[model samples]
Target: MATIKAIVEKSALAGPRSIKISDEATFSLPAGDVFLPAEAAARVMQAYGQAVNEKVLVGMVFPARDEGGWGAVLSFAKEGYVRDDDAQNWKADDLLHRMRVLQAQSNPVRKSHGVPELDVEGWAQPPTYDTTMHRVMWATISHKQGEPDDDAHRYVNYETVALGRDGHLLLGVASHLAAFNQSKIIADGLLADIDFDNGKHYADFDKTTDHVAEYGLAALVVGVAAKKLGLLAVFLAFVAKFAKIGVALPFAAAAIRRRFKKRVPARPVAAVTTDRQEPR
Candidate 1:
């Protein structure tokens, strides 16, 4: 088994928010406050991956090395209250299904562009980090082609959703597809180490004063209320588009030559001159 070292730091999000991450990875912060308004947050997130309509409180990317190929990225977003219907019976499987559907829709687009699609090979909900505070869900994706050869070559993503005491919904997503099992350990550790100020945790919810959300846990996964795609879809689409272009350009050039042959006009031959008087 591998050992991990934890470092607690001020969250890139707003006040009273802090996070913990493994010391092995280097963290990158957005230029400004990550908790920008919905539109601003969406734009900022796009710079990292894709536009997410939700109000992002903070976004951080942990690159395994200074050179940046693979590592872990995390984001915290705010959703309105949880709906009564969904809160009662929502399960991690529901989120997994939603993710699968999104993958199916996005995969073909990626392949068409020549980028390999990541397949969701497995998923499971580990024991909750804090049963009274949040519900956790996780899934693993197939490794990208050409990734470093390693025993733990796989991609894993985790989402922790909780209802804040103020009747607000909070979501935390950790995406790690490159650093093998190292990222997995980091993600789990981060969740376990999360510390929210008083009146912020789910256990602080007040039934009398707090308002109920129109949607529930299911809504968080499927976005029933917003009826819009989540950040994962947007991020995947962005990656596919760029990856396909990079991967296909060379092959596309070759294919183009086969389809349309450009005839180079034959150059006129220069008259030949002989050093001897041409034997005339």
Candidate 2:
């Protein structure tokens, strides 16, 4: 659809560019990547789901030969400094159950919007927190209800959280099931590219003065599965995989007024590319 192209066109950067990830960190996006600022990034998110209050930034499109490019969205949650002591006792089985409950609760809203309900089948990659990097990344394999659990209809929601003294940077990488592993490598690389400012590092959290998020890292996972980013992820899953085969994504949000009907052909959206070719 021209809709997808028009929204995504005109924003490709000839990078090695520095992007401000909220007010907390700097993202050194590799060369030839597109960077969508917070406001522009939020508009893209709103197109797929409900209104969002989170600070959105760094939308990059990776070209995939001819299948069209898949991309990722970055959001920042300033929920104060999050304490990660629970990582030692993290129980992913329990966390997965909680995510499923949240998904069920959101099904009604999904149905109302003409979006098919999707269930969390399981982790494409289990939740892992890096003690040294102070970041967490996970991926969920979700499929449309009643559909066979196959890559053709599978949606991989790969998410990464980079903790900071003030809050955390959220990266939700959307990709086709077949592209999950490659996308994970890219997401991990992007995570490594982020850096906190002088005093904003997670190590700089001062229990005496800094704010601590009421919820732990586990709660962050559950909240993301049911809220703003969750809805965006679902639509993106459709946009990423369905669009690969040229199916038109339904645009149904009252929040989106600028319409695009043009479909941008897929191109290489890898983190770095020497060539600066536009999408076909």
Candidate 3:
């Protein structure tokens, strides 16, 4: 089992923050103050390819041996705070509601691939890591281009919203479905691992000493970050590639065997002579 360790820098936050993921391999970000699992990073790089730019703040990939793997990404607003207007009615549920609408309207992969609208299975504002974190669990059936109707893939996604003590917005998402029931387990593990520096937790907020966030927690979910980052598109792309492997693995195995056989030359057999005739 591998683990991911993210040491959040004091510069990135008004306070210190850190997180560690168990059973996953971690990778450091080029920008510093951020980290992600190596597998998730690879998937993000593969999905975005050359299009990936500095706009991507932090990305994580969770590759489950089972069917429930997913990817997560976090990006900061230029202002580094949620907008003032949106912060007024800030609530996790509202942000989630707005996100669903945005996905229905603007997700490029869903629009082009004709993936069905996201169905909300459940949601909650759970208290974990000594901070209140909002979690949304949803499901969707995505149709592959040219695939039979029955071949639609069922996907489950769990999105989490939290505000760092320093007023930084953080989003964590884990996607899986019926075939991948352990998504929640993985998501919870991640949430529990978060450790805010002595003065950087939500509980440590000080209006006098600490800077206040311009936007509310709600803005973190509904803001342009999701749109600009293209979270759903990146996630779906990962799923497509994951599914593609299932289909291609057998062919790939066969090709490997063929190549192996071709690479090894046949051993020459030397003639064997019988020496028993002298005894007779």
Candidate 4:
């Protein structure tokens, strides 16, 4: 097992690199952040106490700014073309309620791992979909159960998803409530830079020949995607370098992904280099 430093040393500093995820999608990784290939990323995750036990491919990590620079990458779930014709303008209350239900279902797992039960406090950004971009963006603010309902004690998970002709690309960032705004901006920007190949773009889908995903855009927000893709195992972990939030909680998020691996089947994500250039 390589040390974290060794892994980072060997990884590509993708200040401006184009990443292709198994031909399903591509990322024009913007300036600032290193990109770890699967093996190296797996090593880093193990060092952080998570076993790479999921059937899914090990995901690339562009460590949050404090750890390295900051950027993003997406983990592709080749479920199928997601039908979005009728999926528009979902209510925030409905989505948040679903999130809370998912949280309740997972509290037992958290307790088993010696982590405190967590509650979905509210949204840092309401569930919103961008029709032009073919994307869905939402963020949840959560707190350890039994904690006071205040910002300083909250944790933020900002999520962004880009749909394709195949499955969808999941990109996200986790931070304390204080970092939510900056993190959201970065996530939104990163999502905008990713694209699928010409024949693979969401608009390229052919109803006569292509398959559609079981869940629509809203499931991506409320955790229903967890059942089909089991994306929690591929979650991005953020570190704030001993942030001064008014809580005694640990700096990193609880290993939420580690708990859901048993359910989602595996799919390998092979990063094929299609192009590279300066960050435009």
Candidate 5:
């Protein structure tokens, strides 16, 4: 098994409210509280972009390929993670190893089979990266809030595409989803599959206890969009209309009359009013 080691440090540009997840480390920090190593952060963000792109592509209005490519990728990823040998069949792990060997051997003849590289630009964190990191962080919060089994939702590592010549990873731009469907992660750690090695497995390993953090940041984005759309619709619908107390007064009065009826006597209401006005 190829071991992956990753480390996270602190960055001034990354705010205290900033959260980051990478192939090496997952970060949840207050401004200036923590920093993640640049490479690992880029790798994680890249993978995250790919993952989000996959979800979006599968759900696209006009999908590129109709031959169950999404299912094929998922099955392939799962198989590589579990399988042991090539005689049994081919797998992602096998491919990853072969690629690593090619990288190590420096065979320009087989350059096409080498490992993929990632390039992240300055900003623009993708929703998946944010969501995955928040999930881990919130899972921790939920644990603190006394939720059980909240630690089984963590993500260790994932696969993502390499940026172009600039080596920039832009979470905001639409990427080629077909590429992601072909890429795969070497290995991953899920919250449900937590087995602490302290320092035995990879470089970024830590002794901290795991937790399940659920962050519905995407829902928040959707909520904000819905609210904005609603506000825009209302504004457009009522645009160019003159403000009038004439229209507002009747509606306000009706509301007040309803409140008054709730407090008035149910029976003989007219008689009570007549008696009150009986020259008293």
Candidate 6:
């Protein structure tokens, strides 16, 4: 029977993160195997390591407390694998898959089972994404290590919400599991790092946690501003909801031209003779 294996890579920067695999290969023949390619793995692994490291480092720096960090992370990650400026942005789905595969090879139990464990030998192809939003990944790794029931694994799941056309907020929730689901990893250890919240606005700290709390708080804060400022915020919000068409929005039936009210040049009236003679 095939067994699961996991592997980790050594790097100075961000990784030592592993990928996991659940099965073994049938046989080894030519060097150019479809699934297992030797020469390409080194490049793929480097890219994968960089992707994971950046994701984690950015989160740590921003810290996701008041939505500033979370929002930044979302904006950075979801802007396509390559940006308009032509910089490469690693797609989340591709990175997630690579991590899973790499970890599988490093599982440590493959030797005892006599199965062909790939380990984190390396990666062949770069990651590609199907879509930018609505992604979920789950992987489980079990290692006895001569300890009683030493089954340990981790879960990293998150979703991003785009607000209007301008901004986005990301909510990345991660949890670790050891010995089945008997314990809560977030509450016990990871709690301090994340500072998880049920989504409350700072201005309305007194209010109870409820649906749309952030929205309500924003509205309330805007309401407190002087009338002109408050109105501007409300108008900006409204404008963002619609598609940007031209210099002026075509919202109402009256199509007010952005340039001059009327383009027709004024007719030059006959100049009245300033020095009008006594008798015309």
lDDT of each: 0.38, 0.63, 0.38, 0.56, 0.20, 0.21
Q: How much is 276 displaced in model 5, in angstroms?
A: 87
Range of the 10 consecutive residues with the lowest summed lDDT in candidate 3 = 1-10
Q: What is the lDDT of residue 112 in candidate 2?
A: 88
Best by lDDT: 2
Distance (Å) between predicted and true CA of 137, model 6?
4.5
Residue-level lDDT of model 5, residues 166-269, one tens digit each, is 11111111112222212111011112111212232222223263221222222222222221111111111111121211121112334423422333211111
Candidate 5, residue 62: the lDDT equals 7
lDDT of 3 by residue, 103-190 (tens): 5565455445444334332232211121233222222222223334342343444444444444442444535334333445544444
Better of 1 and 6 by TM-score: 1
TM-score: model 6 vs. ground truth = 0.20
User: Could you give me the TM-score of model 4 versus the true structure?
Assistant: 0.72
After superposition, the stretches of candidate 2 with alpha carbons farther than 4 Å from their true spots are 1-4, 10-14, 54-69, 228-280
Cα lDDT tens digits for candidate 4, 1-280: 2245555555635445787778777777555444667666666555544444333342554542343222333467788988775455556667677777877887776567554677766766665566766776666767777767777667666676778898877886565677666666566656656777889988898989899888766666566322311122223332332121122322232221221121231122221121221110
Of 1 and 5, the candidate ranking higher by TM-score: 1
Tens-digit per-residue lDDT, 1-280, candidate 6: 0010011111111211221111110111111101212222222322222122233122211111111111111111212111111113434244334444544544443444432232221111121112222111112222223334322312112221212111122222222222112112111112112221232112222324322223321222111111111111111222222112122211232222211122232222222112211110
Index of the highest-TM-score prediction? 2
Estimated TM-score for each candidate:
0.49, 0.76, 0.49, 0.72, 0.15, 0.20
Report the lDDT tens digits of candidate 2 across residue range 111-170.
787667878777776677777777777777777787776677777777878899999888
Q: Stretches of candidate 4 above 4 Å error?
A: 46-58, 63-73, 146-149, 224-280
Q: For model 5, where is the 10-residue window of minimal lDDT? A: 136-145
